[model samples]
Target: MNREELKALGLTDEQIDKVMAAHGKVVNSTKDKADKVEGLESQLEDYKTQLADRDTQLDDLSKQVKDNADLTAEIDRLKDENKTATADLQKKLETQAFDFALDKALTGAKVKNSKAIRGLLDMDTIKLDGETLKGLDDQLNGLKESDSYLFEQETEPTKPTIVNPGNPNGGTSTGDDDPFAAKLAKYN
Candidate 1:
């Protein structure tokens, strides 16, 4: 309990002094070690906070990347759709223009002589030769005759009488001879 009691209990003064010094040294060393540990713990806590912040930043970056990717994909899809729509509209416009050109050509041809009309309409048909050309000419002539007939029907209140000269048999003239041949011959 007391220093004197320990001394009286058979401890020597030298021994007690040595033990006290050693214990004091151990306590001091323990205190120093504890302070170092506390500093190390604080540093570890700081490192943990930094790691947590980095994780949050990484998560935010990942979300942004995902959003960007999604937006890019959507843009690509819309671009493709727009491209298809534009192509379709262009095709329709081209078809309408072609039809308008054909209609104008036919109307102009009708106003002029059948030969000149045939020449104008048959310009595209001239590219063919041999049987193909003949067939195309026949088809073009038929189209012209039909167009003329329709135009006459729309304009004339009375139908014109058909006069047959080529046919030996009593029949209306079919007008088989290419009426446009004379007009087209000038170009040839």
Candidate 2:
């Protein structure tokens, strides 16, 4: 209230001044409290927004972690399969290479049995030179020299011929008039 109003209500000038001073203090204090409350509320809103953003980021990170784990497991399994396949392929190639080299070495060399010869030979001693066999030819030649009977030339047996009664001994006669003795003498 103003000084005139307080005076009309039968207050002295000094009392009116005192009441006005008290009222001004209360208004200022209330305004200060309200301003403080508004500031606090604004800060709370900002905190809530930040918390929501952080929660979203945490969820995204969790999802990414799970995906990474799954991918790692799949990669491990694929690596295992690749290792096994590589080993199998290498073994198959080695067998084919060995067979090819053996065939080349045994081409013209006579052997009683190719399988038996292969068994007698050692694969470790053989060396491959691109498309050719290095040590296998030498090994085969050594085998042929040591075992001549095993690598002998194949020959047909001769058949025995019947002797004629005209000749006492089996000998080549020029004519029937020539004596068998003369044919035998020429040979002797």
Candidate 3:
């Protein structure tokens, strides 16, 4: 929230400053997570490139093995296994990245319960374009227009803070204040 927005909300300059500081802190925290996610995505892409290179190398090796029947058989078997394994691994990684991004977007959109929101989404329609979700914002906007209660309203004075995974006061906990546990608690 900007200073003007806070001022319009009837807060004094000092109060606005405090709120802005808190908001900035929260935003920076989110940005850090986003950066980490981006790094992971980059790494995943690199793995895909490496896999392609390995496939090329395997093809080269296979050509060299053509003179030896046993070597050719082994190379063919290895090539098939590598293709299947790489395809499965790449699919799994892509799925994970998509899920991670979707959940992050859902959180940033201030959804009250992500599991509930996910049920309303068309998985087929949602596609991940790098860090952006191609169809999610449109769907979220539609949902906000129709099912407003599914999300948290921004008008509230005190925003609910998420505890991160590292800092004791900010991260994981088995207790009530733990963000992960609290999210799980909603379902329980």
Best TM-score goes to which candidate? 3
Worst 10 residues of 1 by lDDT: 126-135
- Model 1 bad stretches (over 4 Å): 1-67, 111-138, 145-148, 151-188
Tens digit of lDDT per residue, candidate 1, span 50-70? 556655655555556666877
Mark the regions of model 2 whose C-alpha exceeds 4 Å error after superposition. 1-68, 152-188
Q: On a 0 to 1 TM-score scale, where does candidate 3 land against the true structure?
A: 0.53
| Tens digits of lDDT, candidate 2, 1-188 | 67888677666666677789968976885586567656656755665575566556555555566658876676556556656655675675566566655654564475656777887777798877777777787778788778766674767633334354775665665566679767887898
Q: Give one clash count per candidate, in the order shown.
A: 1, 0, 3
Q: Tell me, by lDDT, which candidate is best.
A: 3
Candidate numbers sorted by lDDT from highest down: 3, 2, 1
Score candidate 2 by lDDT.
0.66
Q: Root-mean-square deviation of each candidate, in angstroms? A: 54.2, 55.4, 20.7
Worst 10 residues of 3 by lDDT: 156-165
